[model samples]
Target: MPTKTKSKIKITNKKVVQKKNLKEEVDVRTPDGGGWLYSDIVKDHFFNPRNFMQYGEEEKFKFNGIGRVGSPACGDEMVLWVQIDPKTEKISQCRWRTFGCGSAIASTSALSEMIVENSGMKIDEALKLKPQNILERLGGLPNRKVHCSVLGDKALQSAINDFFRNTAQHSRVQTAGAKVIDKELNVTDHDIEEAVLEGAQNLEDLQHKLKVGVFNKEVIPQLEDLLRFYNEKYYG
Candidate 1:
């Protein structure tokens, strides 16, 4: 009986497809692609931006503080200008120009409104505004687009820092990620970054410009490392 037993055969065919809502799918490939739904605030700002400086109009405004952040090569650049009220020590006016995605434009527009709308926000208060505040004001940006909002925050901070630096308020200048690389000479990462941005590409030229490691050669290595990083970040 065992020798005569025939082998049992089973055949089954099925196709399984997992379904997902458009928003839930991550990196789904489609002809039309996918993207997040922007908030109404973002849409309004992108379409009708506030306090934006059009090209060739830089001379119109007498800006006391100026700042630039991000690079065109990286696909986002922002330039912010602030007019400080001498008596109030507040930001009298805030304007900006941006070359980037919708998110960047929207974020900057929101920031401009926040700055000048309420009879001008205080300089210290304005400086305290973070990327999250802009994001929240915009209702929300996609996770991937969150970085764009940071450009607005940085540009504002940079403008404030410039105001402080120009006013000889060195103590008030808050430089993010700036470290005192040369403790002896009081050289910081910000100094090296500025030197590189000003076209000092070589270490020798940078030293000549910033005197970063003049007194302490031991700090040269650290300065060089920072230079390389900033060069690649802002220039490359």
Candidate 2:
């Protein structure tokens, strides 16, 4: 339950549950002669999962996208939803729903909370999460269970990737719309693009310009030169 604090903590390392017919893929070792779980961080979280994935139907937040990761049969799928404030590029809301062992739940819970606490954390930052860090907070994991705990961070990264992918696809929609608008305005593709590029340049220069107006005498001369040049070549 005290999953919020992961900065530094103690772990009582012990296997809370035994896997039926599971092979020992990894051997737990420490500075001493091949000791297993010299510390006990895993057992604590297993008994009381700090951030087990649970969500209400009526959760509040306006988010840009949602992402889910992991295999269901693996029994560890994490769903993450994030809401961003467009004006400030800040995370207005972040939530995670996870299914797995205590470590999985706590890791997810910790990760989501960390993101919410960070508020403006980018997807890149979220991807850096590791199971060791999560275990360090609770205490430490039974050396063998490290892989199981690592799933939480992996799922979080997958979910973050999904959210960004969706966001990028949504962003591309505007370009499609612009092409349609170009047709409707009776503007050639190249002509509209050139105009847009020029407009952007004008906008960039506006900050430094002493005078601003479409009809400004000095600006009009530059416009005339552009018009004449285009008329003589591209327009003809």
Candidate 3:
């Protein structure tokens, strides 16, 4: 009989396996490794935000149009300023301030750069800059962070409306058609819609989330209609 060849078995070192497992655990606890994967461009803009207004430097900016959105109580707010070139109808400068997350900062910063770059975009063209456009420029945001991108475009539109109003172009002022729900808190239908998108399912949920229509019984019917509408529109 042929001599049986000695079989060599390969085994992975236990220490190496333990080290790899530890690395995976650590990764799961970290932001990027925990699945909050932002694009390189988003990180760049978030870390080095552009066109942000320095506190107390607002007076020196010479901006003609100003706009604000979101609520402090709701945990996100943004203010934008624009300087329009009267002769060229182009946005000469764009600046902003936001109390929000990294995505919010990055989105607004990218938007300001977009508006002011290449000799600046015309007001009409700038008005057409949607959240999708900004997301495309930033390589896109996480699904939950998508709402943050809306702050930039909405604030920009408000600033444009301010510019139109300041220039006595009343006819050009565009309204968002947001119906107020709670006068004391200054909540609106838009707020309800956002709450629904954020997982608010019913009137009590809305009340707990937004404090909307709490004391305002008159708007309950309207709020319910809005809640149903949003639930159907978004969930379906």
Candidate 4:
């Protein structure tokens, strides 16, 4: 009954407005959508690593102590050399080479800087340098890459131990987590731990990476226990 009061509505045609094309700037360094953004310090160190030992330069350094860790077969290796001032008992120079990811390179570079800066850090103080300290100096590494940072400090500790041993300070030499697992290849429990951290999930994987327990059947039980322990400790 109210249809008698219906009113006419005006219809208007509106122009469709198109959005302007926006251009986004992309960084060529990170082509994969900015994957894993490293801090500027990390990037700088990675691009131009400090105290890196060039090939054939090791003979020229005259370092007082040398330490090596990890393995090329396991995908990461670090060799650290330290020159200590006997009078001051401070680390005068630190040089290192690593076969690893950018995080590893950057972390070791930062560590060498920390050791040699301010006329160098004391051997005791350098021994106190932990992975956390290196990470703090590095501005931090990614979670998965944190393991890579460990190699630098471990190698540094090994170098420090070598220094102590060289100085006939056997009492100060620390062999805390190292136990020979493969006498033939001189592989140790630490090596097995490193292999585990590098993604070796089982005995076969460990064997592939470190050749541990391959010929040394007697060490298999110990290797199994170590593998389980490291797996739980790192990836549990």
- Assess candidate 4 and give its TM-score to the true structure: 0.63
State TM-scores per candidate. Answer: 0.70, 0.45, 0.62, 0.63
Model 4 spans with C-alpha error above 4 angstroms: 1-36, 179-236
After TM-score superposition, the amount by which residue 112's alpha carbon in candidate 1 deviates from its true location, in angstroms, is 1.0
lDDT of each: 0.76, 0.48, 0.77, 0.77
Instruction: Supply candidate 1's per-residue lDDT for 111.
Output: 91
Worst 10 residues of 2 by lDDT: 174-183
Question: Taking the tens digit of each residue's C-alpha lDDT, what string does model 1 give over 74-160?
Answer: 788888999988679888887898989988889899999998987899988888888878877877776677765458878888788
Global Cα RMSD, each model: 10.5, 19.2, 12.3, 13.6
Q: After superposition, how far is residue 153 of candidate 1 from its true place, in Å?
A: 1.6
Clashes of each: 0, 13, 0, 0
Which wins on lDDT, candidate 1 or candidate 2? Answer: 1
TM-score of 3: 0.62
**For candidate 2, lDDT tens digit of each residue in 11-109?**
879777744222333334567866644234444444554433345543554556555555445566666667655456455567666677755666666
Predicted candidate 3 versus true structure: per-residue lDDT over 1-236, tens digit per residue: 66677557766565743222211212112445654456678889999999999988877899888877775555677888999998899999988998888778888889999999999999888888878888778777766777644588888887886687568665565545667666655566766766776689999998886666777788888889999998888776
Highest TM-score, which number?
1
Which residue pairs of candidate 3 clash? none
Which regions of candidate 2 deviate over 4 angstroms? 1-61, 86-90, 118-120, 169-236
Order the candidates by lDDT, highest first — what do you get?
4, 3, 1, 2
**Alpha-carbon deviation at 182 in model 4, angstroms:** 15
